[model samples]
Target: MSAPAAPASRADWPEIRTGIAADVHAFAVDDPGPLRLADLDWAGAPRLSGHSDGDAALHAICDALLSAAGLGDMGEHFGVDRPEHAGRRSADFLAATLRMVRDAGWSVMHVAVQVVTRRPRIAPRRREAEARLTELVGAPVSFAATTTDGLGALGEGDGLLAQAVATLVRPGDPARPA
Candidate 1:
């Protein structure tokens, strides 16, 4: 191999920024209904609680994207304390973040997320989550599912964890999206 490929020239690539985020929240255990719950899950399944849909994964991913783009965190824009967003959709928040990212002179090149749960395994709905992220980021989004393996508070049965990474691209020539 004569020098392999030397990777690619950054001079030709758009400027990019990246950020990481992680979060965990306790399960509701109070909601009456079940969502895709099955016996294969941990001993018990508790509903998640939050102002929005309570999807820690989505929330964390959105925060990562906003942070990478220099936008404010979720609470500053849509916090539980604000009654106006008492029951809004988390997707909306991500969408707003996407717009803000673009407005702030950046584009979401990609995002990756991991949703950790002992019960109601995340493997099943991972694709759906990726699709939702794609819609917001205006590009391909990747997702992964993992378990604490009885290692953390989440594994101990207190709650779940959501971690995310967002990679943003600064336009090479400030081209507008069509």
Candidate 2:
């Protein structure tokens, strides 16, 4: 029998002339005992624990952006084991992720983040959070807050959770090397 034709590689496929990519990510962090600092800055609020500042919202956004760009998740890019990332601010992570995405030939279109927690009500800081994220990503960012209705770890006031979606666009032809 004659040899079968091999499937075409991505390089041989038709180029994407123009379009946008989107992705979503969810993350949660528990209290790191009584000593660690939390990412959210609200008095009397329990902190989310992690090697970094543990801002669930920013972590989710970074993961979403990386996913939208076909890049690895946050853990791979910035693992807890990496001493350099220790105690790093969430804003710094967001900035670094944005730079990586741009280097990969994509631009941010928008970002939306939703936080779930029983403590540290986000409503009061919604505008400030959105403004800060927007400034970091250099694009419009939306913030939403919700509670788990006294049902989960968050409801129990043990931690915070966040979910985010990011839209990215490739301005030029995709076939061209980034």
Instruction: Give the candidate number with the greatest TM-score.
Output: 1
Where is the poorest 10-residue window by lDDT in model 2?
17-26
What is the total number of backbone clashes in candidate 1?
Answer: 1
lDDT of 1 by residue, 1-178 (tens): 5865632444545678997888677887777433211111232466567776666766787789888877878888788899887755666777787778888889778888777777665676667657766766678878777787898787887777778899998845434322
Residues 80-168 of candidate 2 have per-residue lDDT tens digits of 88999997887788788888989988888888888777767778778887887787778898888889899966678777677788888
TM-score of candidate 2 on Cα atoms, chains taken together: 0.75
RMSD vs true structure, all candidates: 5.8, 9.5
Tell me the RMSD of model 1 versus the true structure: 5.8
TM-score of each: 0.78, 0.75
Regions of model 1 farther than 4 Å from truth? 1-13, 33-44, 173-178
